[model samples]
Target: MKSAPRSAVLHRMVMPGHTCPYGLKARHLLRSRGYEVEDHHLATREETDRFKAEHGVATTPQTFIDGVRIGGYDDLRRFFGLRVADPSATTYRPVIALFAMTALMAMAAGYAADGTVLSIRAGEWFVAFSMCALALLKLQNVEKFATMFLNYDLLAARWVPYARIYPFAEGLAGVLMVAGALHWVSVPVALFIGTIGAASVFKAVYLDRRELKCACVGGDSNVPLGFVSLTENLMMIAMAIWMLLAYGM
Candidate 1:
């Protein structure tokens, strides 16, 4: 004996002629879940409610599968015959995580450099020539030598030693300090050096505030350092100690 096959009904109230956005969303959702059923779109809201009532369906997108009812969109998804999108597949990696970190460290070092200078802000500009201390200690590290001449205003961005401009200047200052000529030229030297230093730091801070990049040392080494504090003072002190020995000779 062959029994009558059970029929499943799908009731929708979507307007006709206008593509059902919900139906489209549902299509994608169902397809993702391996559901290959065709959707039913209603021409009007009234017709959809009427169909629901007649079929004892409770909501929109109401599914009667093999004569069993499922509620709404969410319910349909749970009975999904499709796979879900992988959350991990959409995640991303940080682009500038390491770069920003390294640049930040440079900024910190720059700040410390400025601070140490001002702590021993000597009125006598001649103290700068004391940088001759480098030769005495035989410290040939480019960065350490450059630190002696770090004038933020001059070196923060626009200028770099293409052929040892700073090294030459440091040597000149060292010679003058050694011969005691720096004492006579102390005012002008101090004014020049301090002005350059103050400007350099300010420029770095300004660029940092404006998010501008620094181009120092013929490279793109932009970083920020605020006002000079105890850091630069210590640098000056170290230079001064060396100058005392340099001058003694």
Candidate 2:
């Protein structure tokens, strides 16, 4: 004889204009775990509020198993002995992904253009691609990036607008380098920012021994201020010097 299937009750908000993502996740989790979910939809704001009040809970997507409250999505994960993510934890995922993607892109570009991925041009593309990608991340929210950058950047501390201009300059330099055009413009821009950035990062993370979030990927990133950030700045500096020497600019 087979055992009876486990059952769960899920109360989630499914308004006309919006649906709660956590609620969807909860339902999926329950179903995936062999629980038959009696899904209830709170279709309006008033209905959702009333449900929360009646249950004495602050949030929706509440789950119940065997007549016991399982709370929200994170709570449900806890019930199943799953690891919950801590929002405050420092992570290197963003930087890792950014570097991995840019590296792949560089190889692809090299293979397509020069018929080889192990050439000097490929290495140049890697650095240029990384610069553009990092600049793009910073450009997403300049105000936020500037705020984070001011915490450690010497130039930004002195001149507020430098923070805002940094991303654009980096991007322009990267684009020019990739095109192999306007070495006069790209070399100087990359060298100037790279020098300042490396000095600032070294001072903050090495000399001061401060544990802070890096603004390399973006203002919202949780990547620690350390070797990866230093490497990024150093790569730009090296690329700028190489361009200057190679083109005699």
Candidate 3:
């Protein structure tokens, strides 16, 4: 008779009030991957600490396959050839989620104000929300965003400080637009940055034919440096124009 496959040991945190989320994830992953899991639940904080110390590991959700340590959840992912280990892999998911959230907010705002899911006010709100969201993303890691922006932003390439100031400018514009105050400041700023951005994106992605990541969503983004970048600039331009036309001058 053939012997059954050996089980993998999964030692994870399970305390009185809280259980580690990654531990649950690791357990599920192991079971879903057809490994019989020998789940070892750390019942208390002291037990969890002791387990970590005894295993010479720093985190919970440690896995052991055939007596060889597989580290934590990320390590288990690596062992199974999953995509969790890579930090620099390009993907559009972040930008997609951001834009999706923006759309949802815009729709809700529109409906709340006008009893419809789409309207001019909603459009305005959407642009303002997008500016804030994108600014926040950049502000999360300004250094990273600046490094990426320098790759294609003509102004940032020429003046290093421009990269650092860009997020603040975007955030200020977003706040002013949202408040419906200081149009003079917001409009000019939006037009200035949007026009420069449009030209730079066009030159770098179209004229130069260079494939690069967009810093529109942030420095760590995997968003492609083409349509999405262009769209961002164009939206800003359109919003500026709309605000000007709506309020005059």
> Each candidate's TM vs. the true structure?
0.27, 0.95, 0.77
Against the true structure, whose TM-score is highest?
Answer: 2
TM-score for predicted model 2 compared with the true structure: 0.95
Stronger candidate by lDDT (2 vs 3): 2
Root-mean-square deviation per candidate: 21.2, 1.4, 4.7
Output the number of the lDDT-best candidate. Answer: 2
Instruction: Give me the overall lDDT of model 2.
Output: 0.93
Please say which candidate is ahead in TM-score: 1 or 3. 3
Candidate 3 global TM-score: 0.77
lDDT of candidates 1 onward, in order: 0.45, 0.93, 0.89
Q: Which 10 residues in a row give candidate 2 its minimum summed lDDT?
A: 240-249
Candidate 1, 141-240: lDDT as tens digits: 5554344334443543355552135444444554564444664343234334435654555555666453322222212122223422212333344454
lDDT of 3: 0.89
Candidate order (TM-score):
2, 3, 1
Model 1 lDDT-worst window of ten: 90-99
**Candidate 3's residue-wise lDDT over 59-82, tens digit each?**
888999999999999989989899
